[model samples]
Target: MEIYRAVVARVRPLTASMIRVTLTGGDLPAFTSTGVGDEYVRLFFPHGPDRHDLSLPVPTESGWETPEGRPTAPMRTYTIRAVRPEPGEIDIDFVVHEHGVAAGWAAAAQPGDPIGLNAPTGLYDPPEDVVRQILVADLTGLPAVARILENTPEHIATRVILEVPDKASEQALPAHPRARVTWTHGGNGHSPSRLAELVTTALPGESDLTGTYLWTAGETTALRSVRKHLRRTLGLDSSRFKVVGYWVPGSDTWTERWEALPATVRAELEALWEAPTDDLEDVTIVYEDRLSNLGL
Candidate 1:
């Protein structure tokens, strides 16, 4: 994968737990992002007093290598919330939480500060001929969900189920052609499972799922439950459904469960990722809610 050295061009608060940062630099040229939901990027932030160190290596031999006894820097995974190529800008939405390096950096990011970015090497597109699209996710997966909603064809019926911490995070989604939007807020410190249950019950009737493409992403357990319900209970074709565990509760990264998926399933996903057709004729846009950019 190509690593880009980007400068913090802009930062804004989106919510108490989310921040929006726009980046620009020469590294962005190779980042030919197709649209929302089609890609994801990684953000690498500095650690400790070395925040001013712009001499870090580009993972190549010539760059400054890690000090013999120094600790590793902070890094996080985030979605490309928006991309503007005309001026060479890319926006990333980060969920701010305590003790996270990316969050800490975002909370205090300023223009001219240097950061590391890795270009997307994979794509997550559904089969172009699919008749319908079902998008499901939590805040972590919102950026991808929103992008898919914005770029999907109008004639292809789309349904989105987004679960947030509460009603306050429920922002308006970009209106897409022939799409139904559903926003579910988990109130009063409820668990992620609560959100999953709500989504399971609120899902459209079985009739709406035929010939539909299902995409589910969120906390690992929640994603697993939904995956079971859709494939086992509903008897949906496994080839048409995808469940991505963006993160796990009490864990810092995506689990290996995804890597252990059956070879058949993985092969199907690879096919979707490699598909080259743009069958959608129109794009739909939607937002759940806005939050203060915690600068992270």
Candidate 2:
């Protein structure tokens, strides 16, 4: 666990509403990654009368912990879009939406501005055994989806569904012969081809899913709904999919919402949303034991 200090070296617009901030500094040599494709870090934004230097927390075994009585810095998590060792820089992409500290800062970020970050950790990786893939995302998950596509094996069959606000929001992505990407755009909160519906339509029949994996990110409600259908309706095993929410829309109180889901739904989506890991040996054992008992 380590905290990093970076200076914004460049800002580039990826799309009409998406921005990329490239950070580089001497401290970047110490900035490392676990090399997992979905690795991410928390960017700390300085605030309040007592703190404005963008002071970041020191790392401990438990994680980065802030000291008591210091004004807490507003922070948001983002995926590691690119890591360049030659230039010693990392790229983080931001999709501008409603005003918030992270979005607002990115909207006006300039070269030489200060930012702090920690950890590029997550449990997502291309499954060695699975040769078929499905990727579903909203605007927030576009960067992660891009990373997965660029890194996954080229021979595997892959289908991608992306939800955006409009055509202006679609950006050019890397190409793969086995991949087909569809974009759904709307001016409203979700497009007509919403994440849940598009994923359902793309899921293969039971007989076709032997070597398949599904990765989903974005709106919590849509993602949870998809997870429920995949688990309870399609009877997909717990080991078949990996999921996470980019952000909960319109509210910061996520724990309250989690407390309200039906126990069964919560049980299936909870751990993946909270702490997904690529080491499925541990997860597979726990789930296999459970599945066998139910004759699955």
Candidate 3:
């Protein structure tokens, strides 16, 4: 729940669709890293009429909050590409798009621009006995995927399937001794995502998944389909795979509808989340089904 303040120190283009921003500040010296490959943080940005007036959330006993009469800060989650503790600096890679607040900020970021971020949490945990790692992602999740490749153990064979908009968007990734990478062009906001389909074709049979681990992240809707296939259709255990949705299309509209829901309906959704269950996937299925029924 701790927040760290930093200023943009450098900006550079990584590829046609990605940019890297380097941040440094005194507060960054105290920042802690989880040391997990897919670790991420919630980045806070300036908001309101004065774009330079940073609007970071205030940490309270309950949680973070915004001051009364001030617009909530514009925040987004992003992977920590690299951390250089000695210099009190960290690198964040962003996928540039025509219509996202975070993308816009990254595209125009200048040195000395202020920013804030919370401590990181990670999701890329392969079991101790895992012999092979299957990593999947779209452009939005590429940074984390790259980090995972760099952190994978030498004994584990890795299979990477990356979906980028085009060949130009792809970059050279860290080399793994036992890695096989396949790149497919298309489906990164320009068209429908084929992440689930490609992953399905490459996955081992249900009976052969014992010592394997699967990790994937991308658009929310696309990931839901992947989750359904792995959990329900394949009957895969939740502990064997980590599936995360990095972004949702039309999020603004979705938020508006969610906020307008009746209190009782909201409580129902909360109960679904809090209910005890052995498989988290079951909870997600029911929660998302209810949201779809309400056109959320």
Candidate 4:
């Protein structure tokens, strides 16, 4: 939960839908990367009408805290696109859109602009014996997918499935001798997503799943369906695959609904959140079911 302050060192647009911002200085000298491909960090920026009043949160033993009367900073999660330890630089690739807190900031970011980031956490972990890897994502998850491909062992064969809004959103990904890529146009907020269907269909037969690892990330609702298929239908173990939700279609509305819940009902959900559990998948399923039951 430590917050490391930094300043924008460079800014470059990688594609029509993606922008890369490089950060350096401040506590970056102490920042450490998990060295995992799908690692990500939370970024905090000034929250105001103009968004020029840069106010960062204070790190605490339990988490981070904002001073009383100070507006909570706008925060967004982003993949660690690349990191150069020697120069203490970190690159975060942001998905550009017409409207979004992070996208707006990244679109106008300039060198020496102050920003705050926390330690990174990663989810992609292929078994040592993994023979084949399947990576699936939309544009929002493209940065992590690209990093995953770059980190894959040369001996392992990889299959990449990407869904982008259009041809303009597509960019050259890292090349691998044994890698194959399949791109599908449409479904990056411009149209209905077919990521789940595409991934499930592109997958090899059940008999071919042995020694295979699957990793996917994209819109929350889409990935939820994919998770169900992989777990219940395919009976894949958590060790064999990783699925993540990058964004939600109407997150602002979701947040408002959450805040409007009765105090007692909210307390019940908070208790569930505090309940200790070792099985993440089971816990997630239960939480989602509870949310649905409560009409959330």
Candidate 5:
């Protein structure tokens, strides 16, 4: 858990509810990421009233150590939307909402703003024998889902199900000739049952799942039920699924919840942080929609 300091280099609105922030600085040379799709980092955002301080517990051999008098910053987990180490930059796509630590920080971020971040870790790698896959996400987990979709082998069949409040919130996803995307507006200004139903109806049957992978994120209850259905009802093996509860609806203690994420997944991330393998050269990310933050 090495702490790295970064200064905001660029901030661009990607959609009605998402903003892409590029962080770069001299201090970022030490930041090395495996560039694995679905990798994330713990962001120690400025907290309290001013949102100006970068104070937080420093990582040590034993664990994080809080200074005697400094106020610990609020922490949030965000997918490493993209990485380009040659230029010493990392992109983080944040869902801009009215509240929450990362949301507020992203809403107000500007160039030269300082931010603290640590641990670029990941748990997703397209299974070697995967015949096909299904990806699902909402605004919060869109970054991770997009990363996976973009990197998936194009020869394999894949489907993506995305839920947003409205058409304006739809961010253009990566293009893969063999992949298809289904966009559904999250009815009633929420993303839950409707998206889950789409997922349920679209999944491959048990006979066809032997060489498949199921990856889903976003609202906890929805995906939790999705996972349960895949495992219990469809008789898919647990090893064939990667389900992450990106956020529980209306959760205020998000940081605390993230810290307690599934132990197996946390272990996977910890192992990656310890010994990240895949080395990728300078990579560039492109988005089709150069849209503004037009609210629904």
Candidate 6:
């Protein structure tokens, strides 16, 4: 992925925990992002006492330089909330809290703040052969689910189970896809495990699970539980589904653990991640049309 510097054009609160920051600059036009979901991007925040220029370290022939005189900045991974390709604009949503550099920057972000961003190199959509789709996630995974629903066919049988802190955090999804959406509230600062239980119990019957594609992201333990249930009980192939750990409790960096299965299972998963030519064409068309209609 190529790195590009983008400035904050605007920032708005989507909910108590979510903040939407619109980024725009001449550098942004060079980024070619397909769409939103769980596509990975790198965000470089300013460092130093003044919090002005980027704080990245200078590279040396031997390796990276030492701590002294090295500008130390915080780097974070985030999802693309929305993208307007023609206008060279992209929206990133951050979950704000009391700690961490990314959250701190987001809380204080204002118009014209200079930030650095890296372009996305891959798409996160499931394979075209997938007959049914199961989406399991929390607030962090919501944007990805919404993107999939918007891009996929309306007749597809898609089931979504999302866990949020409360009803107020719930978002109205786009209208392109027909989905059976379920919400579970993690009440009063309770651990996300409570919500995971609700997700497991809500899984469809085994017969309905065959040939389905599953994508989940949220708390590490909770996501693991759902992954285990789908593999052990439903007898579904691992390669046909995936569970990504978006954030781990008590940690600032994101760590992802993919469930390792047999060689056959790995092959199946590889195939699913690769997009078909037809699907790629369709995505381009949909994205172009959406852009034109929005007058962006």
| Model 2 Cα shift for residue 143 (angstroms) | 0.6
135-213, model 4: which lDDT tens digit per residue? Answer: 9999988999999899888999998999998888898999899999988999878898998897789663474688999
Q: What's model 2's TM-score?
A: 0.82
TM-score of each: 0.74, 0.82, 0.94, 0.92, 0.81, 0.75
Clashing pairs in 3: none
Q: Listing every candidate in turn, what is its Cα RMSD in Å to the true structure after a full C-alpha superposition?
A: 9.8, 6.4, 1.8, 2.1, 10.3, 11.5
lDDT of each: 0.66, 0.76, 0.87, 0.86, 0.74, 0.68
Expressed as tens digits, the lDDT of each residue in 1-296 for candidate 6 is 45677889899998886888999994898888855466768788897545557764434565333258766567888878778877778888887678878888888888888787766733455666777777877887787777777777776778888888888788888775458888878732345355456556666554565556877777654455565566666765556666676776646332222233445644654555376653333333343343234332
- Model 6 alpha-carbon drift over 4 Å, by segment: 56-69, 121-123, 187-190, 252-296
What's the lDDT of the predicted structure labeled candidate 1?
0.66
Candidate 5, residues 1-296, lDDT tens digits: the string is 68888889999999888899999994789998876788988888776666557786788996577688887878888889888887889999988777778888888888888888887888676668898988877777788878888888778888888887789988888899989898878732363446568668878454467678877777765664566567557876556777776765556764565566677755654454355333211010000011011100
Candidate 1 residue-wise lDDT, 1-296, digit = tens? 45678888989887775788899875776677756474776666776666666433345544334455655556667778788887888888877766557767888889878887766633555766788877877888787887778878788888787888777676667788688888777621255345457556745446566567877777755554565566556766556776676775545432355465667755754555355644211110000000011110
Pairwise lDDT winner, candidates 1 and 4: 4
C-alpha lDDT of candidate 2 relative to the true structure: 0.76
What C-alpha lDDT, on a 0 to 100 scale, does residue 194 get in candidate 1?
54
The predicted structure with the larger lDDT, 4 or 6, is 4
lDDT of 3 at 187: 86
Question: Residue 256: error of model 1 in Å?
Answer: 14
Q: What is candidate 4's local distance difference test score?
A: 0.86
Tens-digit lDDT string for candidate 3 (186-238): 88778999988877887734547878899998977777767777887778888
Q: Where's the lowest-lDDT run of ten residues in candidate 5?
A: 282-291
